[model samples]
Target: MRITRYIVITLAAATFLTGQGMHRETAERMKDRGLSTLDSYEMLKELTGTIGHRLSGSDGYEKAVLWSQRRLKEAGADSVWTEPVMVPRWVRGPVEKAFARSGGKNHELTVCALGGTVGTEKKGVTGRVIEVRSFDDVRALGESAKGAVLFFNRPFDRTRVNTGEAYGGAVNQRGSGAIEAAKVGAVGVIVRSMTNAMDDEPHTGAMRYDSAVPKIPAAAVSTMDAEMLSALLKKDPGTTVTIQLSAQSHPDVLSSNVIGEIRGSEFPEQIVLVGGHLDSWDKGTGAHDDGSGVAQSIEVIKLMKALGLRPKRTIRVVLFANEENGLKGALAYASRDANVRERHIAAIESDAGGFLPRGFGISADSIKFGKLTQYASLLDVVGAGKITAGGGGADIGPLKPFGTALIGLSPESQRYFDYHHSNHDTIDKVHPRELELGAIAMAILSWAIAQDGL
Candidate 1:
C-alpha cells in the first residue's frame, strides 16, 4: 500500500512537469513563427494606411469598425460581434492658429485645441499672457489673472527616469487648466504640450470644464513655443498672445466596441481577454498611441490559430471605442450582467505602444501573481519575463471590481511620449519585429492562463 501511494504521487508530479514543458515548447514555437512572419506589422500597416486615424464619432472610426470585423474573421475567430456605446462627438474645425507678439516681433507658434474645449470667438481671444506653473500660482495673483490668458507652463519633469512618470507629473495642468483658469476669470488657457521632446509640434488631449465656472477655450502649445513664451514673459511682463481655435463639441453619437473570440475546448465558460482602445486622438494616424495595441490584440488570435493551440479557456479580443476623450466603451463592456462578468478570469491590455517588448505589469493579489509567475519561464525567450505589480489598461480598469486579473503589456516607453497625441505618431515609427514580439508575448501569456486557471 505504501509503494502504491508513492507511485501515485510520483505520477502526479510527472504530469505537472510535462504540462509545464509543453507550455515552454509552445512559447518557443510562437516566438519563431511570429518573428518569421511579422504578421502583426503587416496588419498594422494596413489598418493605419487604410483607415487612417480612428477618433470616436469620425468617419474613420466607423470604417475601422467594419475593418476590424473583417480582419478578425480572417484571423479565424470562432465568433465576432460589436457592442453598442454612445460617445462624445467633438470636431477640430478647419483652423487652429496661434502667435505671440512681443519684443517688437511676431513669433509664430504651433498649437492645437484640447479636445472637448470650447472654441474661441470668431475674431479670436487676445490677452496679456500670465505664465503660471500651477493653479496655486494663479490663485496667488488674486484678481490679477482676470481677463488674461493663463499659460500653464509646467514642462515634463526631465529628472524622472520613466517618461510616463514625467508625463503624469505634468499632465494635470493640461487636463484641468481650463477649469482652474476660469475660476480666476481667465479668458483662455494655454498649456505646455506633454512630451519630453523639445519640438515645435503641439500635442492635443482631452480637457474638461466645470459647470459652475464659465467655459473657456483651451489649447496646447509646442514645448519650444512654451519656452519662448516663458522667456518673453520674463523679459517683458506685458507680452500678449492671440489664440484662434475652431474646435467644437457636438451631441453624443452611437458607436460600438469590436469584439472577437476563440472558444475554449475545455473551460468554455471561462475567459481570458486581450484588448486595446480603437479610438485615437485625431492629430495623427495614431500608430503608437493604440494602433499598435489594436494590432497586437488581434495578432494573438491569429497566432493561436496558426499554431493550432486550443486553449482551455475562451480567448477574446476587444477593440475598445472612445478611449481618446472618453471611456464609454470600457464602461459599456464592464457594465454587462453578472453572469458575463464572472466568466472573465483574466484580461491583458497592450495600450503602451509598439515599442520593443518588455515584461508585463500585473494587477492582482499575491496568490494569483504567484500562480502567474509559474509561466514566466515560457516568456523568457521573448524577453518579457519580468513582471511587476500594479498595472492594467485604461480600457480594462473597470473590471477590477469583479476580481479580474488585469495585465498590461509594458513595452519600452522612452519614445512613446514624443509622438503621443501629436502628428509624429505615425506607422513608420513602429518596428515590425518589436511589434510582432509583443503579440507573441501576449499570445503565450493568454495560452498559459487558459490552460491553467488564474
Candidate 2:
C-alpha cells in the first residue's frame, strides 16, 4: 500500500549472500501459504466491477484512493496514507467520428483519440488520406504528405517471440504520430491499433505534441478498419477522409498516491516495496492494464498478514496514480523523501497484467542477480520462479537511478495486448486463479527480500 526504497545488509549474514538460505526458508513457507490459503480473486472482482474505470483526474480515481486507504487498514496494515501529486487532465469530447470515401462509396471506421492530443475546431479536419507503414515511409512521402491526413498502418510484428517487444516496436507511431504528421503540414493523423488480434475495436493511448512544431489532431483506427483503409487506398489513390475529435487538455489536477505497509518486527525503518498504477485510460475498466496489479499488490499485504509471516524488513504496498500517460506519481514518490533512495532496498512492480506468472525480470548487479536466481527456486512448484534480466515497472522505473534494485513481475504476454487499453479490458477477461498465482509469486519474493534484503 506504499511506495519507497531501502537497502540493509548485515555484513556477517550477507557476505555476498546475506541470509541467503534463511531467506529461502521464509520464501518457501510463503509459497505454501499462497497456494493453499491465499485468495485475491474476489478483491479483483470487486475492484474491476465496482470501482470501474479509474482514469487520472477522474472521480473514479478518487474513489480508488479512498478504497485503497480503507482496504489497507482493514487488511491490518500498520499505517496507511496518501501522498499528493499533480496530474494532467485531458477531456474526450462528444464528437468523435471519421469517414473515408473511395470507389463511389463511404465507409465508417472505428476510432478513438489518443490521450494528450489537441482536438480539432468546431468543424474538425478533413484531407486526402495517405497511408504509410512506418516513419521511414513518412520520410519518403516528404512534401507529398503535406495537407493530407497521415495514416500510420504499421501492424504489430508477429515475428517477435515476446509480444511486449512487438508492442514496443509499433508504439512510437501512436506516441508521436501527430507530431510527425504535422511536420509535413498534415492536417491530422490516424494510427492503427497496437494489437495482434484483428478486430473492429480501436485502442487509444497517450500521445504528445512538440510545441516547436504545429499541433494537430490524432486518433487510432481499429486494426480491421486500418486494413480496410489500406485496401481502399490501393484501389483509389485519391481517397480522402474527414476526421473529428473533440478531445482537449485542461490544466493540471490534484491527485495522490496510496500507500500501506506491514511493519517489520526487526527493522521497521527499512522497506521492500510492491506496487501498481491506479490510473487507466478512459475507454475500459482497466482490469488488465493495472487493476490486476493494484489488486494483487494489496493482496500481497493481506496475504502476508493472514499467514502471520513477519519479515525482518517492512513490506510496503503502493498504488500509484497517473501511470497511463505520465510518470508523475512515480517521480513524485521518488522525490517524496531524500532518504527514499537511501532506505529503500528493492522495489517490485506488477503492471504487465494479472495473468499467470512465468518468471521475474531482476535488474541488478551480478551479486544481487545471482542471489535472486537462487531464491527463485521457491517459485519452482508454482512455475513462476524463472528469473531473467529486466527492471521494474514505469512507476518504479525512476528508483533504479537512485541505486535501488528494481524487479518486475513477468506474465504470459500473448493475449495481454488484445484487451489492453480497449473496452474489452473488463473484469471477465481476467481469470481468478491466474491472478492469484501472480500475487503468490510476488508475496514470496517480498517476504524473501524482507527476510534478508537486496
Candidate 3:
C-alpha cells in the first residue's frame, strides 16, 4: 500500500507539470498567430516607394502627413490629426565648385552646400584655402586668417565601435566650422564629408553661424575630394579655390507633427507613442536615414489593425518633422500641456536606418526592463529579442523630462554609416525584407506592451 501511494503521488506531480507545459504552449501559439498575420512587406512598399523622401517643410513631408492620416483612418485607428508646429525651411540651392589652381591647371572638385548657409553674393567667393585638421589648429591660426576659406578636412575615425560615435566626432566641424572660420576673418568654410568610406558624394548637414561671429558660406566636400585637395595643397601651398553656394534659409514656416492614434479599449487615457522623423538631408532620397523609420512606424499601426488586435493602451503613431536641421516637431509635441504630458506612459523611436532588426535598445529602469523582457519570446519571432537597456533616438530624447520610458529600435549597424547622410541613402540601399522585419518587430513589441500595460 505504501509503494502504491508513492507511485500515485509521483504520477500526479508529472501530470500537473505536463498540463502547465501545454497551457504555456497554447499561449505561445496564440501569440505566434498574431505575429504571423502581420504583413510588413506590403506596408513598407507603400510608404518608401509611394511617399519617397519626406523632408520637413517640403512637399514630401506634407504629403506624408496626409498619407499617414488617411492610412491610419483606413486601418481603423480611432483618430488622426495634425499638430501645429513651426519648422525651418532651408533650401539646398545650386552648388558649384572650382578647385584652386596653382600649377596653371584647374582641379575640379565636387561639393554640396550645407543647410542654412548664405549664398555667395551672385558671383560667389574666391580665395586661397587654409587647411586645418582640428579645431585647435583653427584657433591657433586666429586673427592671421583673413579672406581665406577655412578647409576642415577631419576624416571620420573608422575604428569606433559605433559609427554614430564617429559621426559625432566629425559633425562638430561641419556644424560650426563656418562660425569658427568667420571668427578670424575667414571668408568661407569647406568641411570634409563625415564618412568612413572614401567617396565623391558630399554630405550636407545643418551648420549654424554664431551670433557673435559673422556668417559666411559653408559646404562639405566628398572625402575623396577632400583627400585629393589636401594632397594637392601639400604640393602647392598657393592653391586658390572658388566656392559658389546658393543655399539659403527662408523665414520660419508653418509645419506640423502628424499624429494618429488607436484608442485603447480599457486605458484610453494612457498612451504609448511610436515614431520617427519625417525629414531628411536634402541630398539623396532619405530612404535609409529616416524614410525607413517613418514607414515602419506607420506600418505598426496598420499591422495591428489588420490583425484585429485591440490593445489595452492607446497607441499613438507620430511622424515628426524637422529632425534633420532641427527638432521642431519633437519639441512641439513634448511642449504640450501638463495634463497631456502626464498621460504619456512610454515612447519608442526608430530613427536608426532601415537595416536588419537586431534588437531594441531600451531606456528604462530594471523593474520596467525586467517586465519588457518577459515578452522576449514573442519579439524573437520577428528577430528583435536582443534587448539592452540604455539608448534613445534624438527625436525622442526630449521626452525624458516627463519621466516617460524612452526606447529606440536598434538594427544591424554593419552598413548603416555607408549611406547615412550621403546621397547613397536611397531606396535601393534598403532591403525590403529587412525593412518589413523591422516594422513587424516594432508592431509586436508595441502590441505586447499595450496588452500587458508596460
**Candidate models: Cα lDDT each:** 0.91, 0.85, 0.78
Q: List the residue pairs that clash in candidate 1.
A: none
Encode model 2's per-residue lDDT on 160-220: one tens digit a residue: 8778999999999999888888888899999999999999999989988999889988889
- In order of lDDT, best first, we have 1, 2, 3
Per lDDT, the best of the predicted structures is 1
What lDDT tens digits, residue by residue, belong to model 3 across residues 1-454?
9999999989966764564354344334434543464344455456657766666677877877787777767766778888889988887766656466767788887888887888887777878888998879888997767889889998878888777778889899999899888888999888998788788888877888889988899888888889988988999888878888777778888988888888889998788899888778766778887878877887777776765667788899988888988899889888888436346777889888888887888888787887666656666776678888798798888888777778889898867777877778887788877877788777777766776565
Candidate 1's C-alpha runs over 4 A off are: 1-17, 338-342
Clashes of 3: 1
Against the true structure, what is each candidate's TM-score?
0.96, 0.93, 0.89
Score residue 12 of candidate 3 by CA lDDT.
69
How many angstroms is residue 224 displaced in model 2 relative to the true structure, after the best TM-score fit? 0.5
Measured with C-alpha atoms, the lDDT of residue 418 in candidate 3 is 75
- RMSD of each candidate? 2.4, 5.3, 5.8
Ranking of candidates on TM-score, top first: 1, 2, 3
Alpha-carbon runs more than 4 Å astray in model 3: 1-51, 338-342, 373-377
Off by more than 4 A, model 2: 1-38, 338-342
